[model samples]
Target: MQAQRQLLFGMYMDAMRMDEVIEHCRTALITRRPILLGVLNAAKVVELRRNAALRESLMECDLLLADGQSIVWASKLLGRPLPERVAGIDIFSRLLLLAHKEGRSVAFLGAKPDVLAEMLHVVARRFPGLKIAYSHHGYYEAAEAGQIAAGIRESGADMLFLGMTSPKKEIFLGSYGASLGVPVMHGVGGSFDIMAGLTKRAPIAWQKCGMEWAYRLLQEPRRLWWRYLKTNTSFAQLTAREMFHPDHPFLAGANHRVTSGSPMLPDAQLRSIADD
Candidate 1:
């Protein structure tokens, strides 16, 4: 399928709805075609600007979806509105249900050892009949990645979920995704913690209002306060630059013609620029 992508924050953001993403994964699983799924949010957007390796890894993804409500809002403000936010945790849950229903096997590769075990237990209870092909904690050294990837490959899993933080998950998948042979690979970040009941997701209202980050900050102020402050401020500045400065290098070579509430370049032009 031809991807409908928008150049948002210097990345090609897939304009895919939740159902479309699920269907794409379904097709990939059936065809044994690999899809390295990447998700972007305010924090990641800020980090990518400074982290060349992480940026390169994310750019290698076959699908890149907006994982933060702020990203969707930014897209609209920048006149390249995405359909909606496809949060990583939501997709991870949906995929688990899909795997359970289809009797497909999945592999988990991240989280503390006990947390991983607890997550597996939760999965078995919550998603009975969901085949677990392999599982491991995220405590291994960089040198052991090849062996771990080899084990995942031999597990015959249809999907692999990494519970590690970025850019560890992104870099690992970028390095070993093809060799792992999994049809669908997703870096789910803290979804495993949520599954294990070690962390709580923000309420639906907070999520809808795009205040999930604030809620998270409230949960762990010391560890995340400064990080969120720095990233959120940086992301807001970046978005503002794109909004007020169309001639900026990030949006270079684009004709800023607005049509139907979107200031997107023609599809042909976007394709040409993406090719370069």
Candidate 2:
């Protein structure tokens, strides 16, 4: 848990490690204050600039984690370096481990019907002690959202994971997540496909080199090539320009290399951001 807040690329980012995230998830489960976690990547940073509603919704999150290594690299160049990148998919797995260890009830929302069904099997096999309270495929009518929320609320799940796509996932969580009454919720786009083994994650080597986006492009060129090329190029160009700026405040700070040490955000603050 880290107390000091740093402004990076116009957003406030929390300085936390993986352990802290798991601890927070565990705490939220008992506290009834669900935490909205945003996984900020290079592409998402670009998306935030273009999508005001999405950005605003995400900005209201309880914690904004660096999902892309580029963000960690940028934090260094800016001089207030973050401890690490908290990859969304990685955190998703870890929280599941926590739930399984504690025997917590969980719920699933989003993804195609078959994919969601398959993911449920993967979850069962991987975490045998964990209980899935309820689940629904992502193809519901807009009118069904209230009913979905009611079902999730009634399920008594401590954690809810949404595998829906952008804007819709963000919007749904922002608008109705609190009403669903889950203590911890995360929007994990397409992680179900990976869990279902329909797609593969980047090899550890590529991930370590910060080229997972390239691997994704290699796998789905038609869908991701142009998106990654445009976002990565823009991110690089913008980061380079900021890194060299003489008057950047972070560059002038004396103590920039902060490692794992500090306290956590307040409950009220966390609750405030939990809403949009």
Predicted structure with the largest lDDT when compared to the true one: 1
Residue pairs clashing, model 2: none
Per-residue lDDT value at 176 in model 1: 94
TM-score of each: 0.88, 0.84
At residue 11, candidate 2 shows an lDDT of 72
Model 2 regions more than 4 Å off: 244-276
lDDT (10s digit) by residue, model 2, range 82-146: 88888878888998898899888889998889999999999999998688999999989999998
lDDT of 1 by residue, 1-276 (tens): 775788887788898899999999999999999988999987676656555567788888999999988899999999888898898898999999999999999999999999999999999999877899999999899899999999999999999999988778888998899899899999998889889999888899988888887887789788666666556666677788778664222332333333232222222221111000
**Cα lDDT, all candidates:** 0.81, 0.73
TM-score of 1: 0.88
Candidate 1 stretches with Cα past 4 Å from truth are: 1-3, 246-276
Error of 1 at 230 (Å): 1.0
lDDT of 1 at 114: 98
CA RMSD for every model?
8.5, 9.4
